[model samples]
Target: MKKKWVHIIIISVVFLYLFLPLAATFLYSIAKEWHNTILPVSYTFSAYENLYTDPRFLQAVGRTLLISGITLVLSVVTMATATFVVFMYLPKMERVLQALVMIPFAVPGVVAAVGLIKVYSSGPIILSGTIWILIGAYYVLVLPYMYQGIRNNLRTIDAKRLMEAAEVLGASKIKGFAFVIMPNMVTGILLSALLSFSILIGEFVLANFLIGGYYETIQVYLMRRLNENGHLASSIVITYFLTVAAISWMMLRLGRRFGKTEEIKEKIS
Candidate 1:
C-alpha cells in the first residue's frame, strides 16, 4: 500500500509537471484581469473571439495547412517507395539510406535553412522565398520519421514472406507491393504523417528563415501575435494544442479501423 501510494504520488507529480503550463496558458487566455492572484479576477472569451474573427489568422492557418498537407503527401509517397525498394530488393543499400536520412538530424535547423537559402537563392531553378522551397525542406525534415516508421512496420509484417506468398498467388511484384504490402503499412504511414505534420505545424526556425512574412504560417503568425497581446498568444497556443490533439485522435481512430478491417479480411481469406 505504501509503494502504491508512492507510485501514485510520483505519477501525479509528473502529470502536473506536464499539464500545469498548459493549464496556466489556458487560464491566461480566458482571464480578463489576472493580477497577483491564485485565480483570475474574472474571465471572458474575447481572446478566442478576436482570434476567430481575425482574417489574417484564418489565412495563416490555411497556408500552414496547405503546406503541411502537401509536404505530408510528398514525404509519404517518396519515403514509402524508397523504403520499400531498399528492404525488398536493395537491402545492401539500407545503410546508405539510413545515413542519408540521419543527415537532417545531425545538422542544426538554422544551418540547414541557411545552406538551403544559399544553394537555392542563385540556382538554375531558384526556389528561394517560395512554398516550393519550404516543401522541399519539409520533405527532407520528415525523411527520418517516414522512413523509420514504414521500415519498422514492414519488418513487423514480415514483408518478405508476404511477398513470397503473393508471388505464389500469381501477383507481380508491383501488384504484390501495392495490394499486399501497402495496406499493412497504413497505420505506420498515418502515424508518421501525423508526427511530421505536427512537427511542421510547430516548426519555426526553418519556416521563419526560409519564407518569413512572404508566406506566413501559423507559427509565424503566432510569433507576430505574441508581441501584440498575451491573451491572444495564449489563445493561439491553446488552439494549436487542440488542433494537434484532434488530428492525432482522428489518425488513431483511422489506424484502429484499418487494423480491424485488415484482420477481418485475413480471417475471411
Candidate 2:
C-alpha cells in the first residue's frame, strides 16, 4: 500500500539521520586520507592504535573514569537515602525535593559553573579547582535521574509493603531496608548510575570552565586534540561512543538478570 511505502521511507530517513554521521566518523577514523572523494582511497587503523597508545589520552580516560565513578557512587548514596526518606517517612516533602532537583536543569551549565566558582573560590571551602567541585557538580547534575529511577522502581515493587513486612517480622528499619528494599532497587540504581556515568563522561562545559587546566577529563582531552589531527579526533569520538555503548550494554544485561531473579523470587513466593 502507499501507506506502507510511506512508513518505510520515514523509517529509512530516520535511520539515515541517526547513523549517517556515525558512519562518516567511523570512516574518517580509519581513512588515511579522505578528500575530494566519496570514500577514502586508503584505510588504516593507525589512528586507533595511536589514540590507545598515547599516555596523555590514557591518563585523561583514567581521570574521567575516576571522577565519573566517584560521582556516581556519591550521587547514588545521597539520592537513594534522600528518596527513601522522602517517600517513606516524609511523603509531604516530596514536592519540595522534586523542585530542588529541577534546579540543575533550569540553570545553564555555564551559569552554574560561574556560580560555583564565585562561591567556592574564596570561601572557607576553596574547592573551585579541585576534583571535589566536579564531584559536587556531577552529583547535582545526576540527582534528578538517580532519584526518579530509584523512586519509580521502588514504587513499582511496592517498597513500602516490603519494608513493612520485613519490619513486622521483627527486623529493624535498617535491616528491612538493607535486606528487602536494597535488593529490589539494584536494577534501578544501576540504570541510573550508568545513565549518569554516560552524561558525566561526555561532560565538557562545566569541566572545561571550572577546572580546565587543573583537571582534564576525556572531553577536555578530546577538545585539545581536535585541532591536532582530524583522523585522530574522529578515532577518539568513535572510541568514546563504543566505550559508552559497551558499558550501557553490559549494565542493561545485568539489569535484566536482576529483574529475572526478582521475578523468579516473586513467583516462588
Candidate 3:
C-alpha cells in the first residue's frame, strides 16, 4: 500500500510538472487579463484566432521541419554506417573512434556555437546564418546520441555472421549491406533519426548564436514573442509540445518493432 501510494504520488507530481506549463499556456492563450492574477479576469480564444493568420509562425514551422528532415537523413545514414563499419570491420579501432565521436558531447553547445560563428565569419561558403549551418551544428550537438543509439543496436545483432552469410550467398558487398544488414538495423536508424529530430526542433544554443534572429527555429521564434507579452506565444508553445509528442511516438514505435522482431522467427528449408 505504501509503495503503491508512493508510485501514485510520484506519477501525479510528474504529470503536474510536465502539464502545468502546458495548462498555463492554454489558459493564457485564451485569457484577457492573465497578468498578475491567480486566475484570469476573463477567457477568450482571441490568441489562437490571431495566431492562425500569422505568417511568421507558419514560416517557423516550415523552417523547423525542413531543417529537421535534412538533419534526420544525415544523422541516420551517418550513424548507421559508422556502426556497421566499427562493429563489423574495425573492432580494433572502435574504442578510439568512439572516444573521438564523443568530443562534441564534451564540448559545451555554447562553445560549438561560438566556434561555428567564427569559423563561418568569412569563407567562400558563408554559412553562419544559413539553414545549412543550423543543420550542421545540430549534427554535431546530437551525433553522440546517434552514435550511442545505433552502436547499441549493432551490438544486439550478430552483425559479423549476418554480413558474411549474405556475402557468401552471391550477395555483392553493397547489396548485402543494403538489403541484409540494413533491414536488421532499421530500428536503430529510426531511433537515431527520432533523437536527431527532437534535438533539432528545440536546440536553441546553436540556433540563437550561429543563426540569430535572422532565421529562427520555433524555440527562438517563441522566445522572441515571449518578451512582447502576446497570446500568440501560447499557441507556439502548444505547437512545440505537439511536435515533441510526435517524435516520442515515433521512438516508441521503433522500440516496439525491435522488441517484436525477437519473438518472430523465420524458417529454413
What TM-scores do the predictions have?
A: 0.91, 0.91, 0.86
Residue 10 alpha-carbon offset, candidate 2, angstroms:
1.4
Alpha-carbon RMSD, each predicted model: 2.8, 2.5, 3.1
> Which window of 10 residues has the lowest lDDT sum in candidate 3?
260-269
RMSD, model 1, all Cα superposed? Answer: 2.8
lDDT, candidate 1, 125-220, per-residue tens: 899999999989988998998899888778767788889999999999999999999988888789889878878998999999999999999889
Off by over 4 Å in 2: 248-269
In angstroms, the error of model 2 at 142 is 0.6
Candidate with best lDDT = 1
The lDDT of model 2 is 0.89
Off by over 4 Å in 1: 248-269
Model 3, CA-based lDDT: 0.79
Q: lDDT values of the candidates?
A: 0.90, 0.89, 0.79
Per-residue lDDT of 183 in model 2: 82
Put down candidate 3 lDDT per residue, 1-269, tens digits, no spaces.
99999999999999999889889888877888766888899988877766666788778878888887888778787777877788888899788868977888788989888888888879787887788888888777777888887877766666677789998898987898888888888887778778777877778877888777888677677788876655777776776787799889988988888666544422221
lDDT by residue for model 2 over 1-269, one digit each (tens)? 99999999999999999999999999999999788999999999999999999999899989989999898988888899999989989999999999998988999999999999999999699998999998889889988889888888777677888899999999999999999999888888988888888888878998998898788888899999988988998998899889889888977896787677668657856
Give the winner by lDDT: 1 or 3.
1
